[model samples]
Target: MARRLFVENGFHATGIAAIAKESGVAVQQLYRDFPAKEDIIAAIVEADCERIADQNTLNTAVANKDRAGIIGWLTTTPCHKDESGDRMFLEIAAEGARNDRIRSIFQGIRDQADENISRAFAGLMDSDMVEDEHRTLAQAFMIVSFGSIFLRTLNQEPVTPASEKLITCLIESATP
Candidate 1:
């Protein structure tokens, strides 16, 4: 409810009372759960991280050292069609730019994503080590992934082909 409200009315415009009303929870209970709006965002981020981590598909591919699995995961993993969820993240991202706490939360998300991508790159290259180049490639993958989300949700543009090609090309070019 708060996520939808944040996406629809933005972070600043959506107040605690509004969130409480929308969620049918008392404002005091909401405050007990989340001290501030930023806390809500933080909880949302943590929940999202848990959800993705729970998938474990990439972890399985890496554990098995499956190049095909890694490549498939990289190319097809994160192209979500959930506009509300994407929009909510974008809202949090925008808030991140101005607020230090939010920025930290957002950076944590990016760091975790980078680590996951790096692990996948290691598996794809059949290397036990994660190198600087792997981190660099992981960063590029995040750019393509997030940029695709931005374009798809905001501009209503199709980004699957381009994103998949870029991810695949990155993997192919980086692997020996």
Candidate 2:
């Protein structure tokens, strides 16, 4: 409920009372569950990262060292009609720039994501792909993927083949 509210209404506009009303929980319970709005966004980001890490397709691609598959999934998944998750992610990103607490959460998410992407890169490439190479590629992928996703969502554009090709090209360029 907090996630939905935060995504739907701007975080600043969504209050405890609104969340409680939307969730059918008492305000006190909501507060007990999450001490503050930052807590909610942090939890949401953490859960999202965990869910993506555990996604069967993601696990299979990583386990199989399928770089192309991961890139395809990352670039295409956010094109869904309901872009609430992507929007919330963008929201958190915007908030992160202005708030230290949100920025910390973003850093945690980035670290976790980097580790996962590094593993994937390691699996995809041969022994020549060292830890530093993996980190570089992983970080590049995140920068491009997240920036592109946020921009595309903000522009309300449909996912075009050109955009898909751009991601593929970017990933290929950074691949070890």
Candidate 3:
């Protein structure tokens, strides 16, 4: 409930009273669970990560050793459809730019993503592919994924198919 409120209202807009009221819990109980808005945001981010990590797509990608399949899975996943989740992720990302702890957490997530991509690609490509090339593709993939989310959130344009095409080209480029 606190996560929803924080995502909908942002860090500054959400209040403990509102969280307590919405959650049907005492304000003190809410405080006991989370001392600050940042804590709640962190918990939300953690939950989102866990959800993504536990997705069947990740399992399929690992088992099939398919780069394109992994990209397709990532593009089609509805994980980011939650408006509150999107808003909260953006807010924390922005805050990460200035906060060491937030930055560290964000960096950890990025690292894990990169590692996963590398593992996914290892079976699709030969040893001739360089680590830098793999990392570059992973970063590009992340950019496209996040850009699609933002564009969708704004109702500007749908970038998912375009991003899939871009990722396909990237995979080809990394091939031997």
Candidate 2 residue 119 C-alpha distance from true site, Å:
1.7
Q: Residue pairs in steric clash, candidate 1?
A: none
Candidate 2 runs further than 4 Å off: 55-82, 128-130, 170-176
**What are the lDDT figures for the candidates, one per model?**
0.84, 0.73, 0.68
Reference-based TM-score of each model: 0.93, 0.80, 0.77
Worst 10 residues of 1 by lDDT: 48-57
Candidate 3 lDDT tens digits, 64-165: 666667655544542346665666667777778987777777777777777666555553565424377677766786787677667666774556677678
Ranking by TM-score: 1, 2, 3
Per-residue lDDT, model 2, residue 54, is 54
Which candidate leads in TM-score?
1
Runs of candidate 1 with Cα error greater than 4 angstroms are 53-55
Number of the top-ranking candidate, with lDDT as the measure: 1
* Candidate 2 lDDT, 73-161, residue by residue in tens: 55544333347878888888888899999989988988877876666656566433448877877777677667666776888876556
